[model samples]
Target: MHQLEADALTSPRAPSFIVTLYGDIVAPRGGVLWIGTLIECCAAHGLSEGLVRTAVSRLVSSGRLEGERIGRKSYYRLTDMAEEEFEAAARVLYAPPPQPTGWLVTLSEAETVSTDWLPIGPKAFIAPRRNDVLRPNAAVLSCDTVAGIGALRDFAAQAWPLAEVGAKYDAFLSVFEPILAHVWEAGAPPGPEALALRLQLVHAYRHAALVDPRLPEAALPEGWPGGRARALFVRGYLALTHAADQHIGLTFHDSRGRLATATAATELREDRLRRECLA
Candidate 1:
């Protein structure tokens, strides 16, 4: 004759908020936050319910989270592997760059702009359109339209298909580091001109690689790159340039006469990153 046990279950919010909060908790490699507790915690951070749910579903599917059912309640926590991986990612995200001083804000207000077309060197516009003459420097010379295509070709030639892609990332970053260093050294207006061109190319390649969908579109031109890897590469490439336009005031003038607005979020991030605007 034991009395019936009272049930303990937390009310559910929008699936999206749940997922995103779960990710925030797990992403820092911290302790498991009870689903009930997490809702309150994340609400303060302004995460939406939809984003939380989406994040949770993604983590579960990706094997980053585990749930334990207890009567009417379920408790979820990050797995050890997820903890390790997420912590590593977090370290990279917050890692301090060599130059902590901000120097990007001194450009004239007129110099700051964002647009759809890629900004190019007058040389790129005037240089003979001979694609054959472009030599591979693996760093400073890599451009979005051509250098990116060559990266794919180099990747294809690798014994392990992804090896050259990894190499390309290393090479590109190596080039980017020096450009950033110079900016930290000389400030914005007088920084080496080569620094801007190199930054543009790197930015272009990064965005071109990452801006596209994670899934390949069937309609891509003949000899299309496929699979998640290629899609992610395209996304990175596009996102880089998008960041520039939104933050650094870059305008892209493509074959078509059109302009795309820079994202306000990008501008905010730049405010934090650039020396001139830091609060």
Candidate 2:
């Protein structure tokens, strides 16, 4: 209901798909989805019942989900671990567009990259976390905590590599541009098609977000298209909230009450905020 895709409910695996189902449908209002409902929904996407049964068994064995038996019915919901994982993932998955506040990385020669942060520069890799820093050799010049403006384009090129990640953005824009255009044409007021498209857009954009390094606009190659992609995503999703709400109502079987309260669905929801790949 919160601009997530049921088909994309996970990150391209059975477990991830289950995670997506939990996060997208179950976690929103902190409720459970019945086994039958889940099976039916998954079937709509061509997931066989046997696969669903296997995935559920695997998830329960790993403690990511808990199955509950209520009288003659069965249901499933997120376990604490899944809830925590989804919470962390939701922050990144629904993050606002990239706004890389330039990082100042000081490259000191290191013998090993075993530290919590990834080593970059020379033998090191980029820092894994935004706040991570390397232990200094002390023999080198004092490091600057902020990224230097000089040759940032080159730094980005060497570090993040424009070819693959840049292609990801290009692919995202290619798919979404037409969808956004259609949203403009259809105007406001949501419909089933809009909701379906919005979920699809979120799913596709999430994949791109995972692939992109999310470098600062200044550091990226000339004619960077992330801004365009973000703008298009924002436009397409906002216009489709009506459609998403329409969907939730129909899916949940309580059409009027949901429609009345669905007003809150348009709160500029976002995920995957960090330029994590760059950091």
Candidate 3:
């Protein structure tokens, strides 16, 4: 295995990696994958066939996947519930860096805030005002500037685990920066390798980006790594998509045979990422 691939597959676990594979690759390509294809892909990550089977069974039991048998073959796809979750995640993973739209502060003395909202004080919480995020029902206020910039940043640091999140972003950069360099020098990798690297890139970035509170620039600590990480992800993913999609078309399968290389959904995502890269 390439050192980069080895680094990407560190502490590989079957279930979450499979979810990453499905969300990044299969979900966009009709959301169904044959078990054989699943096993083959997981094998590249050092997961055994038995482990992959067990993981798939667990995902089905947990309602994240639903399985179908066509002849002697088994195929799995994300359940509707899982699809909704993955769709929300996809928006974050693939979309461009969001513009600062201020913050939504919600106050509710009677009800508890959702995990999505960071609790800033008793009965008060805050979250970035993005279109994808549902607004919480409470006494809500939109604030572009909460206080002095330094104080607001301090308050943000106190409310969210910015240090920990920054560490995650730093880790992502450490892993992917070299991979990006390799792509730049040697060009896109082979089909299967390209697919693996792309999945790992998304997996690593998602680990950091999803946990991020995604506060506005004024609210974030100076020298934040998140923007740099986002730029790297966008560039690397776009570089790999052509080769990676070729691998997906040739290798991945469902009851219906090979997966589509390009769909409206896939094209739209590529377009958005391309625009983001230019932006």
Candidate 4:
């Protein structure tokens, strides 16, 4: 791993760890957590006292977190907006993706065209999930979607960068395959290292998935790697679940009930998706 990546995996100062702490721990347990609890959690990730303390202050000033003090002790909680944001993100991160039924898009016309997300020869953009058509000074047309466009295959090929997404999946697989090989051992769960490693692993894979629009398996390029990657992620996470939970129990006394609460909240989110969106 690069120095940056190695540090990210080990350090609680990383945004990824903060996200993990908020999403996996705090959000589930009702958005309120002690500053000391957060510091201790970060310490378990091998971060120093000052760095974690600074991170909490930064998050508070940025309005993503709110801090409260009682008798010289500090408590922190997710701001309402941040809690809502992370709740939505967790659904996308954990649940199966919905196939793109109707695309939301914007189009532009020009004498010359820009590079990103442009069809071959570059006329307009279909405005994929990540990329959009933003011209400097041009008339633009936008729509929810043109339902069931004909010759969809050719159009999809022109609009989205499926090959690039495939390559990202491949990269994720290559990096984690060796690490996941024995993630699930026969007997007792591994210790704190396993918890840190698993969180880092989830964060890395989640980053890859977020960048991807996650097109249907059928529409993807030949030999797409996303399926294998998701499978590995789920399987690897399951393997570490027990160990990670143990770490949580051992390290943070205040964190009790957070995981169970988070699981219930997650089920509610997933249930809504099953009824309203997936169905």
Candidate 5:
């Protein structure tokens, strides 16, 4: 078996893998899935029924999921709080490559900084500009590059864990590159395998991409693997969607009936990813 397939079968925890399922599949199909369906899906990743139940219960308690029962069968969907969080994550995972905005530099008297802000030095942090970020007790300044792209790259390497993030991208490429090659040479795997592969692809890429500071290309090291990884993710995901959707249509269920195989929202998401890959 391929290393990527082995990793998919062995590496995921019940809770995070279930989150991946909801984010990638269940959410787009109306955000609810029957417990039996959830268990069958999780079993592909070697998660036991009991483990899935415990994880679902924990997710409900933690405000990430809510459960309902119809007579004897149970179903779960994301909570409002979890939906908001998932939406944020989906933007990172599905949106096109971010354009290079100038930096937001913060000067604070506090010793520590929010995880969103990268520590450049003592009492100072920097991040990509976003309107929503709170810079409490800090003088925030928007910076435009006057000169020295090299200097900015060096500073970014130090401030953000670029090397570590690069390693993650490298690992992602190692796993998915082979799968993409196989898909191109042959075809997508069978429906069940396709669904499992698609979920694993999202889970692995999300792990690497979310932690990325997403610095401007000029500010990043030469030949960064992030762009390559993003392209592969888009291509591989789009390639598998047909078979995976077939699996979902046949196997996924909720209280009302079988979940949608594709919705308008899911189609838009595919279009966006296709545009990104082409661009």
Candidate 6:
């Protein structure tokens, strides 16, 4: 019997954690470091004090992160070099490759189950569930086996305005298909290297796709896919969207009230299919 081992699947937290950490640093305003607020930010996201301290130290040494030590706290801000490196990373992500745009809809349905379903960050707990809090084990999954494809496809269409996003989304798919195919064929589990690639691709895709220009001075172009950076952002955005959907059975729309009703279950099948395949 063929078995799907846990290691073959991607490390669920790596991509999201890296991106989120970078985001926290970049978005700090009013003298607040969002990354410092929670223990989970460091622990669950694999941000050890040593790793972060070293990263900050190097950035400071290299002039990417600049800060003043006020009494005991070290507040870091991006230096010009840091901004360049950050934008450079973003640019590489959205860069277009020599590929066609037909694969987006196809790869949308690839599943990531059969891999370990590790939670991203600590599970959000509260007395009353917040509307924004993602449900437990509902938003994460592993593409360790073929079974994961069905779920992956379901996630893409939901997270992105597939119909609206159009060609750029398709272009994003073109790059992903080959990677997915390689993973499937190698039957190899993701070691550190493979996992790093997966994380890179996912983060780059999401930032491209979903970056809110509503954000003050969003560094990228208004609509992505117009430029190399945007394309990579969309690609990384989709990857993150797909990963989150797999890990948590997540949907931006409400899923709790109707899931129990028979009609809703029947409706869920059709709705789920829309999610799985772009067609």
Top candidate, metric lDDT: 3
lDDT of 6 by residue, 1-279 (tens): 012322233333433444344432232222123224322234433556566566556656766556655555445555666566555444333332222211210111123321111222244211111122222433332222234444544443353343454454555555554554454566423233333344445443554444321111122123434344343334333333333323222211111111111233223333433443332
TM-score of 6: 0.31
Off by over 4 Å in 3: 1-11, 109-114, 121-123, 137-139
Overall local distance difference test of candidate 2: 0.56
CA error at residue 97 for candidate 5, angstroms: 5.0
| lDDT of each residue in 48-152, candidate 2, tens digit only | 788888998898899887888776777777788888876655555555334655443435455543343334557544442233234444332223225555576
**For residues 1-279, what per-residue lDDT tens digits would candidate 5 score against the true structure?**
345467534558899999999999987778889999999999878899999999999999999999999999999988889888888888888874465577788887555456668766787878776554556566888987779999988988887889999999998998789777877787888898888889989998998998887876778899899989988999999999999998899889988999888998788888899888877
RMSD of each: 22.6, 7.1, 2.0, 7.4, 3.1, 20.8
Give a tens-digit lDDT track for model 4, residues 10-57: 343445577777776567667777667677667766777788777777
Please report the TM-score between candidate 2 and the true structure. 0.66
User: lDDT of all predictions, in order shown?
Assistant: 0.35, 0.56, 0.86, 0.60, 0.85, 0.36
TM-score-wise, the better of 4 and 5 is 5
TM-score of each: 0.27, 0.66, 0.92, 0.66, 0.87, 0.31
Q: Please, what are the lDDT tens digits per residue for candidate 1 over residues 19-110? A: 33333223332335445444434343344555565666676787877766666555567788867754443222222123211111111122
Residue 65 miss distance in model 4 (angstroms): 0.8
Cα-based lDDT at residue 79, candidate 3: 93
